[model samples]
Target: MIDYRKATVPVWTLATGDVRVPALAGDGPMTAERLAELRSVLAALADEPIATLEVHPLPEKLDSGRGIPLDAASPLAQHLSQLITQSARSSSTAAKATAAGEGLYRMVVPAKVAAQLGQGIVRPMAAKGAAGGIRGAFVNSTTGRIAAGATFVPAGQAAAAGAVGGAGATAGVAVGGSAALTVAAPLVLMAIAVGMSAHADSKRQQAIEHITELLEQLHEQKLEDEHSELDGCRDAIDKATAILLDQGKLGVSLGLDSAVHAINTALGAADRRLARWQSALDKLPDGEAVEIGTLTKSFPGVDDHGGTFRTHLELAALAIALKRRVNVLQAVEHAQSDPGNLFESFVRALKRDQQRLDELESSIAGVLERLSALELARPNGLRPVFTTGEVDRLMSAAHRIRKLGDGVSANSRTTDLAIEIARDKDGSVVVFPALPASA
Candidate 1:
């Protein structure tokens, strides 16, 4: 069994010249055959003629890879095409085609589920038609081939590079047929650039971009990391597509096993730090005074300032944050799944983790701010040094919790396959498409 906790697979884009690198996903290990299936889907991506910035179905190979059926007539395709057309008509064209990055990504499939499906099912599940909101837009489409995205470069950089030169020139010519058009050209270009930048920086795209970068770096430091050869890199050009698309069982659980391991490791560190911190506090004066002949002397103690109390509070907060992550994971694990609503369960799991991380992040930020506000007393001074190495470790622990928690949440959102949640009159949860949205 390939340890999913340590398994790394290749994901890349034509924009990166098809230079595939091992991307990390920590759900659990998979059979060697499953790994091969994932590779096949990635291999199919090289056939894309343009940079694909949205989720797309893995194309079935035809005629020895020289031909691919568009499948545009599929209901999934029609729905996606409509959404894309609407988005384009309502948004700026310049920002629509920017390259964020693209590559292979794993879906959150439980081992038992995989075992039941056996081999050859992976491609179908990955290629299965599904739909939901993506990057703040509605989408209904088939996905699971490869996680791909492309967003614009920074507007300023794009403008400087004259990336949209052709379109800009055409617009400029249509506006003024006179020589003064030259003078107005720069203003027109600048305006277009600003508009592109504004739309490209929308929260939807930013969130997606953030998730993409996180996945990119997830396995970068692993010793077994590998990348495709330069000769294998495919040519790419800017192509503006839809902002919304779907991936498979996408959520915090997508990297559940890896995240659990990370949280456990950090939890252990937090415990050790707390114990050491308490030990250091004990060595400090506890209001006792030493008598020297006719004089009474007492060393500076924790009672002299509020920093020690705050440090302790911060440690407790760190512990709480780590525990909260574990709790969320448990909640996901316990969520009922019996094949009927298994997919919906995954969506709910992602949403639950996302919501909890929001609150946990606020708590973590408060702890970090409090830690930063304290001024450590001189080590050689009489003041009790509550700032021990453990305090530093506590701060680091808090950061790790925040980073991992936030990344998991973002990953869930970015790769989420579908999000269909509603409440019936009785407050019973209802998932859409599979059931009526008003149910």
Candidate 2:
């Protein structure tokens, strides 16, 4: 067992022809040259028990009985300075070791004594004794004060020990060796997993393209079907209009009003469907490309060999325009039910409805022109192309229908005397005039 009180003071003794200083006591600050002198003097006095010296006040006389100047510039100071310079060089080397991931054991010392020491010092013998099991060193830079605990090791040494074992077996192992391989395996596997996930995402994007193409095809087909249905309805209105006009000219009437109403109703239905198709077309995703030829070919009953059917289609389109005019006239009559501000509302509604009908009529004319051009481009042997005159006839008929609608619109504006009489307050009580006198 060690005595704690004995460890606290800086007293050196000689034994076995060598000087031994207490590790804890010498750990205090002292000049390198002074420490070396003390060690040399003690070494010369081997086996001698030296008195405990007070380091605070230097003596006026020494072992040689000569006055020794303690001033930093004196000869004695110069000798101390050389020893201090050597100690400083040694301390610098130790500091470098510490800086290179080495641990430090700080030994606190008084500042004034450290200045007189001329150099920082670490007693190797004291460091070895104080560090029981931990590896470290004792550092001193003072002459009069006691030092504290000094054992230390590199800060990373403990963590390195945990990596291997408490025995520190793997501390010297290189980073890229088998030990590193064990850590890298999981990271490599994780990278491969991420790459495969990215590939799968790319495939999903491709599939989306395929699905969008399919949707586009379906939408085009729906449009063709709607166009065909509208064509058929237009044809029916044309036949009815022709029959009614003939009946009216013959004074037969043939309930022409009802036939006109039927034609108008059919045209209204077609207009509503066209509006719906336009809405759906507008809603399609932007930049969606479709094959124009595929869309035209998808129409049922489109003859590839003769192409004569296209002219019939053109005529059908013209009929739809005429039917639309009839519908507008009927709409104006219906709006006449509200006689209040009737003229103002009627004129506005008529102009708007007439504009829409004109636009549809223009579209019909454009389609007819395209069909005619397509026919002209074909070989002459294809069934005789419908005469341009037939298209002109259809247009003339549409113009007549428009004129008839305009006439009906004008008639609706004229206030009926019967209506005026019916609206009179005393209309129910008809008063008979006095009997006329005979001449």
User: Which ranges in model 1 have alpha carbons more than 4 Å from their true place?
Assistant: 1-79, 85-264, 267-347, 354-360, 378-439
* lDDT, candidate 1, 321-354, per-residue tens: 3333243233223322222232234334434543
Tell me the tens digit of each residue's lDDT in model 2 across 55-138.
111112212111111223322122212222222243443333323221111112122211111111111111123431111112
**Which one is best on lDDT?**
2
TM-scores of all predicted structures: 0.22, 0.20
lDDT of 2: 0.27
**Cα miss at 434, model 2 (Å)?**
47
Tell me the deviation in Å of residue 210 in model 1: 16
How much lDDT does each candidate structure score? 0.26, 0.27
Strongest candidate by TM-score: 1
Worst 10 residues of 1 by lDDT: 235-244
Q: What C-alpha lDDT, on a 0 to 100 scale, does residue 286 get in candidate 2?
A: 48
